[model samples]
Target: MISKKMADAINKHMNLELHSAHLYLSMSSCANALGLKGAATWFSVQYREEMAHFFKFYTYLIDQGENIELLAGKAVPNQYKTLLEMVEKTLVHEQLITKCINDLSEQAVKEKDHATQIFLQWFVTEQIEEENNDRDLIAKLKMVGDNGYGILMIDAEMGQRVFTPPPGTTVMI
Candidate 1:
């Protein structure tokens, strides 16, 4: 049985994941406002991915016999001054998520909760990919440096991403 503290912590992470989905959805709106349809599409895909992640953990809580609650999220961020700035902000956010996952992993081990530790391993590795991808975008954005042609090229590339989780692969949280 998981401790109440562990359950609450998982719940909090689940809420944060949902909040992140909303945050990305808001970002997609901003991209639409700026008329970057391809970028908006990419953000939309990301938004959906975040929602899946949220549900994965939430369902895990339910499976484990924990009471679920709907938590309020902070307002969608609207502070980036430019598209590149927004991408940079995204990279930073992903890094923060990686840190949170690492902290949770450490806590699970310290509590002798092997199940959580196993569940967290997936997120830990996922974070690596997430951070690397964002950082790579930042690097490429810098190289392109507001060039319309480059941005469009990237926008086209991002548009190709489709949400297709593997069959029967649930978030074993």
Candidate 2:
């Protein structure tokens, strides 16, 4: 069983994942309004991935008999001077999330919750991939530069992004 404090932290992280889905959806909407279909598609795909992440923890908490609270926060601004800027911010945000996951793992270890620690190990690895993917995408965007054609090419490339969550893990709740 997870400690109350650990359960609360997990629930809060679940909310962050949900917020990420919302934020990504908002970003996708902005990209669509701006006539960047590729960018919109990219964000939309990521939005779905974020939702998966949210539910992963959501179900976990429910199984643990902890309440998952709906979190409220300030709306994120989708406004950006450039697509590169948007990608840069995404990379930075991903890094922040990786750090959060690491900190949580450390806390779980300190709390002596073996199950929680094992569960968090999955996240620790996932965060590495998440950080690498964002960083690589940002690098690709940088290579594309600021030209209209370059942006279109990047858009075309990003449009191919489709998340396929692996099968076989036992889902909680």
Candidate 3:
């Protein structure tokens, strides 16, 4: 069993995950509106992955015999000044999420919840990959600045990204 404090923290994190998905969905819409179909696809795939993350936390809480509380999500903006701006914002948002996960892990450790610590390890690793991807894209965007052809090339590359769930994990898209 997890401590009440830990459970509450996890629940709040779950809400944040949902909000992340919403933010990505908004980004997808903005990309589509800007006629960047490939970028739109990328953001949509991210939206799905975030939803899968939310469910992971939700299932874990349920397995711990905790009552789930549904929280209302705040509004997500569907406009961006430029593709670079959108990606930069995404990187910043991901950094915030990484911090949140770290806080959760710290709480788990303080409470002496070994199970929770183990559970959070996956997220810790995921945040690494997530930040790395954003940084890589930022580098690419910086190289492609003001070049429509370069932007299209990056968009095509992002379009090829598919939602591949971890082995033995069933993620609903």
lDDT of each: 0.78, 0.79, 0.91
Model 3 ranges with Cα > 4 A deviation = 167-171
Give the per-residue lDDT of model 3 (tens digit) for 87-135.
Answer: 9999999999999999999999999999999999999999999999999
- Give the per-residue lDDT digits (tens) of candidate 1, residues 1-173: 77888888888888888888888788888877877787788788878877777777777788789999888789888544556776787888888777878888888998999988987787887788878877887788788887988987777777787776522236622
How many pairs collide in each candidate, listed in order?
A: 0, 0, 0
Candidate 2 C-alpha lDDT tens digits along 1-173: 98999998888888887777777888888778777888888889888877778777877778788887887865887777776777777778777778878888888999899888987787788788877877887888788787788888888888888867633234421
In terms of lDDT, the best-performing candidate is 3
Q: Pick the candidate with the highest TM-score.
A: 3
Worst 10 residues of 3 by lDDT: 164-173
Give the Cα error of residue 25 in candidate 1, in Å. 0.4
lDDT of 1: 0.78
lDDT order of candidates, top first: 3, 2, 1
1 or 2, which is superior by TM-score?
1
Candidate number that wins on TM-score, 1 or 3? 3
